[model samples]
Target: MSAHYVGQIAPNYVHSTMQANSDDDSFTFTVGKLDAGMAILIGDKASLIEFPSLLLPSGVSSGSVVNIRVMRNDQQERRQKDEFDQLQEDILHTFGQQPPKAPALRLRNVTQTSVTLEWDRLSLATATLLSLDIYRNGERLAPIPNPLHNTSTKLSGLDLNAEYTFHLVLKTTAGTLTSPLIKTRTHTISDTSGISVCFGHVAEPELLEASKQALTNMKAKWSDRIQIDTTHYVCTDPRNPGAQEGSQGAGYAKAMQLSIPAVLPHWIFACHDQKKMVGISPFYLDQDPPNASSIKRSVEEVLGKQAPASSATEADTSGSPPPPVEKEPSSATTTQDAPLKSTPFAADDVPPSNKESVGVEEVSSSAPPPPIITTSAPSEDGDAEPQSTPAPPQVVITSSESSDRIAAAAEGESTTEDAVEQTQTTEGAEEDADGEMDEVSLGGPNGDDEQEEERRSY
Candidate 1:
């Protein structure tokens, strides 16, 4: 009967437990973990009466023993259920639990040390509401003012190029509800001393980090949000000025617009290599940065140097002009190889069989690539300051195994320096770590011309 009574009155509730103590009709016991149990026990028909003589705490009078108690006829939770629910809701709202929706924060501006956050004020959350908690990475942050009616706040003292998580929370007797996590990262600058950079949302994270480190070393600043002083914008695509004004991206684009030159990664590297602020004129990369050499020329232009002109007769900027051309390692095919320019050789100087061979003629077959250049002596201190010692002319080739000079033409001859019929003492004879002679060899295409053979060290 009691179970059936409970079924109709409180289907999803537990029975409350109570102890009948004879001490002044008082009892002490705990309620079970069920929401409607106590409420069900407080039914309208609940009553108290004297217990049977056989039961615990039995007595003649109702006050002498504890029993199921009934509410006084004048007592009631409230005049109406709606009033009770309204009262509960009012208490929850009074404690900042107006039933808030999640806060969706949008990134405003980010700097190396701080970030600005913008969000809408939620309907249930009001100016007089209880504390609106701000949290970063689950750790609560203070100081945003209670009843946080403001729609935006700025977070400071952050790491550059680092990730951060944030959310909003409202706590009250009703329960705890929190906004979804909003994750973001700060920006790193490119050239601290030169441009104040503002990286856009579309920028690469790794590139931003690298640019920050590079820029810091360069003494530049990178910011997450655009500031009035930002000089440049680093991104793959920057919008035009005055486009979408007041929008999240428009302000940043305005900072990037004209007067400020949009630079490329090429310019970054070029500036680094040149150790100065390079121009964006040709360094703009619609694609991958141009090859390093091209960037080098661009860098030089910014450095105020006139690009060198090409000459039909190519000259080696390095001092001693390159020796005459020699046949490619392979002779079966003709190649467009041009050798060093030289004066016409005398008819008597050429072998009789090949009389037409003069000036810079390619060496015939059997010629190996010219020997590596080993040493170059500075010219006499004449009128000319050896304009940047051009690469030293090819030196003589000698065999490490013995003192014999090895060239395609110097097949058999006493090793000697150029202009000397007799050998000069091979001074400073030394051995290398491998126990081999520290021999130096300088060979060119004029394989047989001993005149071209200078000093030989082995």
Candidate 2:
């Protein structure tokens, strides 16, 4: 006999009859089919009992007349009903109780098409947790093994520039418990390149590009010069302080200062996350990220060894050089020097040779600076003598006024002792009694030495 659920009958259930044919009162019986159901339903969806297989033990021969005993398992049914009612009550109690929350939800590698999301798991009891269901924008998505199992997933093919919210639900017989809401935005189809940057010698292009594409999903440009338009310098290796005398970046630090930010590759991603260009002093090659500094040695390192730095300055109306200094007349012994080869220089133009152009400049009455004496290098020809010019005419003065004039001329007009220029029209003048001075020297012929000595005594 098998139990059958009969909703309309007086008993409300039935002992199902077997379809069989009996030959005699105590003879052969061939039982064919028996209908039964509703023995046990685990979680209400799956059937746990199969009546066909429960007719007899597995080794019993079929179609044999056997004495059948029918009995009602009322006590087992009552016990099963009590258990199910208790389970329903427990589910309600747990549902009313506060649901355990998942650990922090973190996002990474946000691109135009996708993003990576990860979160920590809550250590809920096995009985309390049935399955974990992921939800995006309130829509239920895939289910995981359980809530206690922390996991990660790659969300792909999302709308560009659109924001999305995600969460997880702890599903159980009691009810569903939702995790904390995590808000995020997908990458947009951006064409803006943001800022220009250059790479250091040690910065690996492939690694940086991979990292960049993973985070930004865009191509980055690499520059050679630290132009006024450039904003950052991506460096892989550490840079030294340029205060040292022989440091390669010393000139750039001290004079030619480049104002561009010198940073690592992560700075780009960080700025993108923050949605703007923040302080990058912390991301220097030699310094830590998100750091600040007063002495920007990294600037020198990025600009390389030069002066007048590569940055845009305040007074540069147009990033061009001011006019050259006006030449003054303070010297006749002017020396010529080779010009500077480097196009960009600060302070002053540096000549190609180590020797600098230093000479006396001749000037008029309102001379700004006193002339500096310049010595000529020795002549290459051994026999050639140095060219010498006569000094100004010497005048013997009898009056104090004439003496004052001479003194004034000595202080102001005398550019060089070798070059003595005098006013042609002067009333107060008595030429040196030595008459006309000869250009005679020791080695040269001095046949009139006696006369010259005699003329010296006025």
Candidate 3:
């Protein structure tokens, strides 16, 4: 049926007459019954023919007689075939004649240890892609992931100052196509072009600015924020502990965890001045500045040697002569003649008038203490009598000896002589405290005579 004659209708429905046909192709049929979508028809020869009920004339129910004709339109069929052939020719001229083109790869970036490559979108024409792979130095590295979608890839851990050859092999249903070989040389270790730095906690603003300027002069890339391609982290002075970690932000920490070197700002300046990359070991934030420990040690050694010399000089300047050394006291020295005072008596204990009268005798170490004398008041007969009594035991201690003894005693490490002296001293102290002192009489021998004399004098 002509498309112009076909009107909007249900897909499962059909019209009664399909086309105008000659009577030569026409036939009469009597419908016996309608079963499902098929109609049983009885032909003139009594043969049974199954016809589609949908193609039968409309309103012709079961048991109805109808004439049906079928014919092929040679003109319509010929026209459709010509149209299909023309469409095939157009496709062949536009796309089918060409095969899949090889990938055109080029270098996006080059570094001391890595390279990044990019290419145009793939053109497969009508061929089915089998695999796309990358090759380096005549060895196949690996197939590209998502070959039809991805257009770039990075190759890393390459040797510095080394030459490399790279190409792409695209495998498809039609044939294999390989890109042109690209020759490249990796940057040397001293090349500053490979440096990509991120700034961390920079304690000195001036230093940070200087470092940034240096990076620019060296043709290196830098950022304030860390990224995947960041090769170094520049921060505060390396001598400071904060430069290693605490003062840094999340980016700095991430860079460290990623194995990126954290260096001082001086490193950038150094590289700029030298026009080449230098060793980062001496510039690492966690490391002490080179030669610092050695310098400190040298200073300490000088100071150590100077201290004793200065002390000796001061000693020599003082005018007082050193105390004379005394021989060790013998066991029999100064036998306990009387109870000795455990501690020295205060000078204030003696009355001002008696101070001159009291004498301190410095005896030999083996000599006993002299007896004390008390003078009697003048008698009416014009005679003064003197009375003698035992005085408290006194020790003649030298300055150096006393100091050593006191120090040793304080430390509970006194020598044997000190122990014996200490024992005697303690005993004497107890006796003085507990025992009564005797009275000395300066009056006349006869008590009655003395009283009578006093009465007469009055």
Query: Could you say which candidate leads in TM-score?
Result: 3
Clashes (backbone N, CA, C under 3 Å), per candidate, total 19, 17, 0
Distance (Å) between predicted and true CA of 179, model 2? 1.2
Screening candidate 3 with a backbone cut-off below 3 angstroms (N, C-alpha, C), the clashing residue pairs are none
Give all candidates' CA lDDT scores: 0.45, 0.43, 0.60
The candidate that achieves the highest lDDT relative to the unseen native structure: 3
lDDT of 1: 0.45
lDDT of 2 by residue, 12-108 (tens): 2222222212432121123333334212211112212223435443443333224332335677788989999999889776655545555456664
TM-score against truth, every candidate: 0.28, 0.25, 0.38
Please report the TM-score between candidate 3 and the true structure.
0.38
TM-score of 1: 0.28
RMSD of each: 21.8, 22.0, 30.2
lDDT tens digits, residues 379-449, model 1?
35434231222211232222322333233234422332331221121111211212342244432344436
Point out the higher-scoring one by TM-score: 1 or 2: 1
> Which wins on lDDT, candidate 1 or candidate 2?
1
Minimum summed lDDT over a 10-residue window in model 3 is located at 1-10
TM-score of 2: 0.25
